[model samples]
Target: MRPKIYLFGDSITEMSFEHGGWGASLVNHFNRTVDVVLRGYSGYNTRWGLKVLDKVFAGSSESESVLAVTVFFGANDASVEDRCSAFQHVPIEEYKQNLHSIVSFLKGRWPTTEVILISPPPIDEPTRLLCPFTENKSGLPERTNEAAGNYAKACLAVAAECGVSAIDLWTRMQQIPGWQTACLSDGLHLTQTGNKIVFEEVVEALKKKGFSLETLPVDLPVIFDIDPNDPLKSFQGI
Candidate 1:
């Protein structure tokens, strides 16, 4: 079977296959070399993600070739505890523990599979108000950039504890000028350029691990290698 890279996260991940999305671009980058699977749950926090962890990997085989699995929760978990969106909030400490548990589970289930942790992007409180993706009758932003940064930091800590790779998207985007407007669409989700950033980062992570479009073997011969005179012969030993 083809090796797989699983993307697990919230809405940002759930919608990552949309046009100009990072997941779609990742597929294009990998071409036929690997399979990229999406297991994103919109509006979910680490708590909910932990609850469904078993079901997500229920049918997996111990020996199956899973190249990597990315844990990218925390946006909802970062919701302010006193806000209308608090229903989805998981305490920062609990969030860390849950993320740790997730990485442990994936490592235990597939010892060779690389685990990557992606921090939640920062919130644009002002734009979130105008966009109104959530039910916010409180007349205040349900999430804040500072809160999101804490979660992002927690995610990085967990990655360090687990000795795995991580992408600090929260901090990375903020480093660039106008990133608040340039990267996000609804102050939480990604724009096309934002998706490009993620795709490039994920690619860099994989490349760091000695895996890349050029390094990983393609699943089958390229069309150029197919012999019209004896097409079936090329597939005999595959």
Candidate 2:
């Protein structure tokens, strides 16, 4: 069976196969070596993600072939509880618990499958104020970097506890000079450059786990490997 990379996260993950998305970038990078599967849901938090975990993995039990799974919920979980988007607000503690549940579940099911936890990217507060999640007359953003930082930290803690890998997107993105505008499109979503950062980071993390594109075994031959005299010969038994 072919090796697979599962991306389980929120809207940012859901749209990862778009033209310049990070998921698509992975697909491009891996080519025929490994398949990148998308199980992303829009506007989901760790709470909802936890509830649906079984539904996504129950039908697929090919544990050995499962290379890695990225758990990337939290942007929605960081929502302000008293705000209009409070429906998605999960307390920081609960968020950590939910993340722990997710990592534990994946590792339990796929014993060798690497679980990479990606914290939500930094929020662009001023832009969010101008374009709130909903029409909040309070003139406030539903999410903020400070609020999301708690969840991001919680994510890193969970990874450390679980002894797995993690990407501290919130902190990493903010470290850039103009990250507020450079990384996020509005307040939450990622721009092309932002997606590029995510793609690069994932590649680096996977490389550390010994899963680089150069190291992964290729499934089929490239065009150059196909013999001009007998093109079908290469694929007959593959």
Candidate 3:
């Protein structure tokens, strides 16, 4: 296959709607430079991804031609279980363990892979209210800056521990003015515009680390068939 960058994550990663997902936006922003392989699955946690790593990897080979791998997760893991479902407020330790497993699995399977860990951003309270399921989950409250920060820190620590590149989108999202309003339509998910903001920041960070769009093939197809309801879809128009 042409050079590919596989994206592994939850709904946020899979989000490719009409306007486009973060992945699509990422592709458009760098279309002149790189092509992408989308593998983001909705409602999946790091724990579950570990179980399906083989399937994920089976889609691509470990050849040097593969450009990179980006993993974006944690929103669903932090979600609160409601009405008998696994909740978001995953204990910090469990979250850490789950992430550790994912990282280890990646390293073991592709020792030479260029891995990137992207921390999920803080949720907007009103955005949370927009989703009835999330609203009903009392234990899983809207994401506070502190909680979001903690999660980012944990993710960063894990990435460092594993010696991989880390993208701290949480802090960048929080620093923006009217971030809550511009970033999220509800409390937890991003709006279309919000996703653009995310894609831009992530691309900038990647560029800083010497990842240029000029490195990948241009004929690779873009994956934009994302579900609008997906958490990552909130960033649809953005």
Candidate 4:
């Protein structure tokens, strides 16, 4: 049977566009072999994600099996309001703590579940430079993306510490040729082309991990191994 993968994030993830987000594209690319769940919520931070885990953790079971989970947060958490203008810049310390809580809670709930931490893509120059509110934020160019990159790396460090896996979207996203145009629009979120590229990359990574698109079913359902009333239940398969 194909493995199930769940995606968790905010607006960048909430909309898949005509080509669908990476998650949806993953499903389509695999042609119903791997089950993909899109639990993207707009304007939500990691704080809000924890509160809404129930809907995101719906698929996975001992019988069906859950392969992995990809987490994309820190966008909203990074939002900052400077001189009457709002930006997406979460404090480094608060972001770290939030991630810790998120990872700890998930690891506690599903010990065997695989977790992946994805950093947000780079910010667009025009938006960051032109936006009157966010232009003066501490991390204008390098710092903004750096914080997110660091956050992802932190997750990688934690994953390594905890013996899990991590995907460096920030690093990889930067490497793509014409990436500035291929992967982002308005400094955030994937354009249709961007989502496709991400999906293809994810598929490649999954293949490297031994997951075959030929094995999963397109419309597979999620499985819950624990009781619904559990506090950690919200994070199962997350």
Candidate 5:
């Protein structure tokens, strides 16, 4: 059976297959070797995400192996309760617990599936203010770098406790000079450069776990190798 990689997260993940997006980059990198499954739900937090995990993941076949599963969320969960977008707000403690639950559940379901938790990226409050989503006057941006950092730390902690890999995007993005201007298009969403960062980091993490795209067998014979006279030869070992 073909190997699969699952991307599960919020809007950042939902839009990951767009032009110059991370998910699309992975699809290109893996090519015919693996299947990239997108299970992103825009505007959904860990609270809602946890509830729908079963619906989204359902069941896996014994013959089907999942190479990796990326759990990316916490952007909307970091929403300030008192801010305009309180609907997406999830308490920090609850957010951490939910992440633990998610990792545990996925591990239980897919014993061999590698889990990679990605922390939400930093928020640019000033740039976010310009977004129509935060039009009305409010105390602070619906989300803040500080608040998202807190969630990012919690996410990392959960990953450690759950024995899973993690990508600390919050801290990494900030380390990049002029990240505020280059990494994010608006205040929260990733720019093309930011998506490249994610794609590279994820690839690095998978490599560390011994998942090398170069080592995987091609899913089928190359089109150029398929002889028109004997097309069945192309599918012989597939």
Candidate 6:
């Protein structure tokens, strides 16, 4: 069975297969080496994510092991409680607990699977206000950079406590001058540049945890090495 890497999160993850998306980048990077399983639910927070964890993971068997799992959420969870999108709001304390629970649950099911937590990217309030999705809506830009930063710190804390890796996108994105205009498209979703940043950070984090495609055996034979009349020979060992 092929090794698997699961990307679990909210809309950020769900939309990651789009052209130039971070998830797509990973898919291409690990092509033919591992299966990239996307379990993203648009607009979901950690609380909602935990409710469906079992359905998504379904525990790995001895024959099929999960190589890594990236738990990326918080964008929706950071929604202001009194805002228009309050339905997706999760309390700060609960957010932290939920992240811990997610890590613990996944670890229990697949002890060897690497867990990488990704905090929500920074939000651009002005751009969000101008976005058609939020332009005429009340309580516009329901999320703030500060609120997202808090969640990002919480996510990092959870990773440290669980001995896993984390990508603090909230903090990292802001470090880039004028990231507000260059990274996110609607203050919430990522643009191509934002996706590229995420893809690079995720790759670096995975490498630090010893996940390297260079060491992983390809799932199929190189096309050039396969004989047209004797294809089985190239796949003999596999």
User: Which one wins on TM-score?
Assistant: 1
Sort the candidates on lDDT, descending order: 5, 1, 2, 6, 3, 4
RMSD of each: 1.6, 1.7, 10.5, 10.5, 2.2, 2.4
Against the true structure, candidate 5 has what lDDT? 0.91
As for model 1, its CA RMSD to the true structure in angstroms is 1.6
Model 3 TM-score on a 0 to 1 scale: 0.78
Off by over 4 Å in 2: 227-237
Regarding lDDT, does 1 or 6 come out ahead?
1
Better of 1 and 3 by TM-score: 1
Instruction: Kindly list the per-residue Cα lDDT of model 5 for residues 1-238, writing each as its tens digit.
Output: 5799999999999999889999999999988888999999999999999999888887555457888999999999999898888899999999999999999888887888899999999999998888736454864688889999999999999999999999999999998888997899998999999999999999999999988777777776888888999989778765
Off by over 4 Å in 6: 59-63, 132-140, 224-233
TM-score attained by model 5: 0.92
Put down candidate 4 lDDT per residue, 49-117, tens digits, no spaces: 777775566444445566767777876665543422244455656666666667776666666656766
Task: Rank candidates, TM-score, best first.
Answer: 1, 2, 5, 6, 3, 4
Tens-place lDDT per residue, model 3, 140-226, is 444555666677788888888888888887887777788887776665567776787667766766776667665444443334544
Model 3 gets an lDDT of 0.69
**Which stretches of model 1 miss by more than 4 angstroms?**
226-233
lDDT by candidate, in order shown? 0.90, 0.90, 0.69, 0.64, 0.91, 0.87
TM-score for candidate 1, please give it.
0.94
TM-score against native, each model: 0.94, 0.94, 0.78, 0.71, 0.92, 0.91
